[model samples]
Target: MHIRKDLSPGKQSLLTTGSFLIPLFLWTIVSYAPFIWHPDIKLQVSADRSGVTTVFTAGDRVSKEFFPTFSEAIRVENQAIMEAREQNKPIIGSRRDNLKKLRHLAPLAVANGWLEVKEQQNDEKLYGVWKGLAEGSLKSTEVELTEENIEVIRSNWRLLSAYAPTYDSKRYPTEAMLKLIPQGVSSNPVYLPAPHEVIQAGWRDFTTKPDNDMPTMWERYRHSLTIIFWGFTYSCLLGIPLAILCGSLDFFSKLHEPFIDFFRYMPAPTFSVLFVAFLGTSDAPKIMLVFVGTFFQLVLVIANTTRLLEKSLLEAAQTLGANRRQLLKRVIVPGILPNLYNDLRILLGWSWTWLVIAELIGEKTGLTGFIDTQGTRYNFDRVFPVIILIGFTGFFTDRFFHGLRDLLFPWTEEAQTGAKGPITRFILRMSNHSSYADRTKA
Candidate 1:
């Protein structure tokens, strides 16, 4: 007697290793390609005694306008030195430069009440105030002035101040720099609708007007379930019977195969448009689109499975003196059951893709409809979340059907190991215990 093994240890090891390496390879390719191929653009900086401009490779840096220019930057540096002079603190420029003047004057300014420090606008404001005070026009008492008033004075002071002679005065601004100032200074930050605002606006438009309001996330989820339920119900009703007829009879197989194949390739969007025209823009069109989307695929699947059953199993049943009804009940139906379950799982996945087109036809609801509305409004952030939801839901649903398959066909080793839920474990244990008791008695 020979013992049969479906999977050998070596084959199993190979499969396990392949699975691990494939993912690692894919991740490496996806993670590294973008970085290596496309590096971030570098900025070009040009400076003259007048001012300095920074040109970025991409779109303008709008934040630069509020930030000081290079000339203003230098003035800020000079102001720091002058402040040290007022404070009689040692000035530190290059290591070689003497700080004796700043050190000598430091305490005198403090004693005279000329040097003042306060928790002002920021480092920039503090520096501006120090510059003003060092120049002798701004009083140390005015350091407590509001930022708005300080800014007014700072702008006036910048305009009146002469360029420092220490820095070079000649350099032509490049096209990049010429472009950078306007682009940087003029560009405004992109604004997004807040969640509260989005919800309020969506409701205002959706509730009062036609085709304006998009469905909420919950609404889309509910609609998805509804479409899946109805689509499955319709496909099972129409597909299984047609499959039986086509499988059992040669005449029907010849007649139906061509027609089913034709519909299988017909685009869902085209069908959606036609359904909308025929049925008008209502739930009927949406349901019909889902039906058409699922039906042809289910038919092809069931028909193929049924044919295999008839050829291999039905002949044996007929020889055993079984009538058509008995043969169907005992052999044909059970033989097709596993394949039918598998087909339904595939159809469920296809239904989601179809639902997108279905929802596009004046749906005003469901995930696809929500995506459409987001795209129209240019709300890419909102659009991305919906896409992620759809992917996760589809994955979970596929896992569910696979779980169902395992529960129904527990004789297969794949089924037993695939069962993940506690309830499935309980059922398997009870099933095993009963089988063991019968074996012991025998």
Candidate 2:
């Protein structure tokens, strides 16, 4: 309640928790509460259209405006099949295709607790699900089947049962089965998947082996980290020394600042093709882009921090007969190191801002690449998890570094006023005064 004052640690932690929970609470309300802005129907059961190759399974979302049209499309296809059956000229069905349709219910069965996740492809297990539903043995608690869909379930079960008491893929009937009616509950648009839905999707995608020889999510995550590591490390290698020289000497400052100032104004992305042409499409260009995105501003900021060293510190060193080398080594370097650490930490986050653009420069790779691919396909559920991964990665990284700052620079105003974490206390105990077992110098 005090003005311009830091709150207690308990209050700070409470506020931090509330910051995240507030948004999550609003999201849950939007996603779950019936009277909220849920304008779409998230499918709990889905089916294939006769000629459409794009098979929508359970968990797909469609706008309320469009759901009726989607339902009618499948309804028309089913009526045509029934008429064909009545005329004793049933459409010639591929046994494999009809068997595939029965397995299509696998997702709904899993959702309804009628089958296990792995049982989706277990044609026999899924057949049992169909029989249970048809005979009113398995209840659809989470997602009730529409009256039309229940009838389709019974009708399909008849064809399946007549073929055999249990599933036999080779013995599947050659008669076309009716598509289940699409049924769903109200939901937000695709971009705003429910929290539970996101959690389920993230778990499934992360654990399941990716198809098409692409990298796993963790692989992509590591690749991103690698690019960031090299880029920031290289930036430090060159930028830090240049920044130190520029800050400590007028000659170095005049030599470098104007050109660096001019180059930074040109957007870093404009050099994308140039970096690719010079380095070729791979990690090299991506690393270079992150470097470019970070390096110039890094030089300017650290140089300014260097200049901010108190004049009395440098004047006193000179008066003590310390030469230029001694002044830089003893006075200027130590004077700026704390602030420099903070500058580098801030710039590291700036480098991450370039990650998405950097990854897009060449052959797209890393988490950003996965996000680009999934986003373009409108698989926002999958995209959300990756995005959340990136955010968590960055947020916690900054937090970890911030935590270390107090331990690393205990003489600074922040460290002097702030509380030390257990890791900090343990590290100080190990390094500073600990000698005899369980005792240290006062």
Candidate 3:
């Protein structure tokens, strides 16, 4: 709790864990609690809009205001069909359409334990479910079917039965069918899917093979990591020596600093078009954009860190009759290793921030490509996994590098500062005292 002080490791780890957990805890509450910030309804069962190509399947969420409107639209259609039948004029639809219509209740049947997940589109199984429900042989307890829906099911079952006494896709009725009314539970907006939902989505995406020629989730992930690795690697290759030379010599500093300072302000994305034209639309442009975003800042920050090295240390090296090359190679480079390592670690993360922007430049690729496409399509649940993956990759990469610093530069203040908790110190003290007592008795 003291100013400019590290917490005991135990407390620090606990608080670090809490930092992530607290946000997740809040999200879960907002998602699950109906009276909380559930401004939308996540569909448990869903239906199609007439003449609309956008099919909202089960698990799609709609705003609460829109849910009733959506459900009512289906009801109106069913009601019209009902009136048509009573008047001895059946509104016959395409047999294919009727077949698709019956399968719309598959989600409802699945939810009510009347249909297995794999059997959702199984029209034969679904037809039997409708018969059972209409005849009262099966019932829905988990999610009670609305009274209106029960009527629709019975009416639809009668038409379907007379068309064919049992399940027969070929002989299924062409008479217009009832659409399942959209049903859902309270939920947060699509942008903030629940934790289990995110997990399920992540698992599905990572495990499932994507359609078309698109790369799998893990392939996209590896591509993203490769981009980061190369971009950061190229920057370090070129920037470090220049930065070191600039920090150690005023001549090099005056030569490079002015142009770089101005160039850094130009913003990396502005050159996206230029890069694409010069490099063509491939990974080359994307890699360059990431490099451009990170390189200028890398030079400036490392130069400053290099300059922060102790003047006394340099003076001692010079007083020992070391020449300029000796001071540059042996003193300055060796002296700044700890700080330089930290600077590179931070710049590595900076490159990640530019990944999405870089991916957008020409042809979208990598995890950013998937994220951009999904985001544009408003599939935020699918998008969350990639975003979370990027965040975790950067976090763990930084932590891994930070841990390495302790072993690599044990002389540094940060490495030496593994503070002990009070309980840990107390236990050690008692153990030492017991050892001393035993020694005295001996």
Root-mean-square deviation (CA) per prediction? 14.9, 4.5, 5.5
After TM-score superposition, the amount by which residue 204's alpha carbon in candidate 3 deviates from its true location, in angstroms, is: 2.5
Write one digit per residue (lDDT tens) for candidate 1, span 1-442. 2368446656766886798789657645543454432222111221222233542222213244333553255345445555665686725333111111112222223333554423221323333433554455755441133343244334323422332212222211111110111111222222332334445555554455344454546766798779767866887898888887787777888899888898788776686677878898777788887888888888888888888764656778788899989977788888778877888888888888878877778646687776787788666446655675688788777866676676687566566444244444454467687753543354
Which residue runs does candidate 3 get wrong by more than 4 Å?
1-7, 47-57, 73-100, 109-126, 137-143, 167-179, 417-442
Q: How would the candidate models be sorted by TM-score, starting from the highest? A: 3, 2, 1
- lDDT of each model, Cα atoms only? 0.56, 0.86, 0.85
lDDT of 1 at 106: 25
| Model 1 clashing residue pairs (backbone) | 87-105, 87-106, 88-102, 88-105, 88-106, 89-102, 89-103, 90-103, 206-213
Model 3, 259-311: lDDT tens per residue?
A: 99999999999999999999999888888988999999999999999899999
Q: What is the Cα-based TM-score of model 2?
A: 0.80
Task: Show where candidate 2 strays beyond 4 Å.
Answer: 47-57, 72-142, 155-179, 205-213, 421-426, 429-442
TM-score of each: 0.54, 0.80, 0.84
Cα lDDT of model 2 by residue, 263-282, tens digit: 99999999999999999998
Model 3 earns a TM-score of 0.84
**In candidate 1, residue 225 scores what lDDT?**
75
Over the full model, what C-alpha lDDT does candidate 2 score relative to the true structure? 0.86
Q: How many residue pairs clash in each candidate?
A: 9, 0, 0
In model 2, state the lDDT of residue 419.
66
Candidate 3 collision pairs: none
Summing lDDT over every window of 10 consecutive residues in candidate 1, give the lowest-scoring window.
174-183
Better of 2 and 3 by lDDT: 2
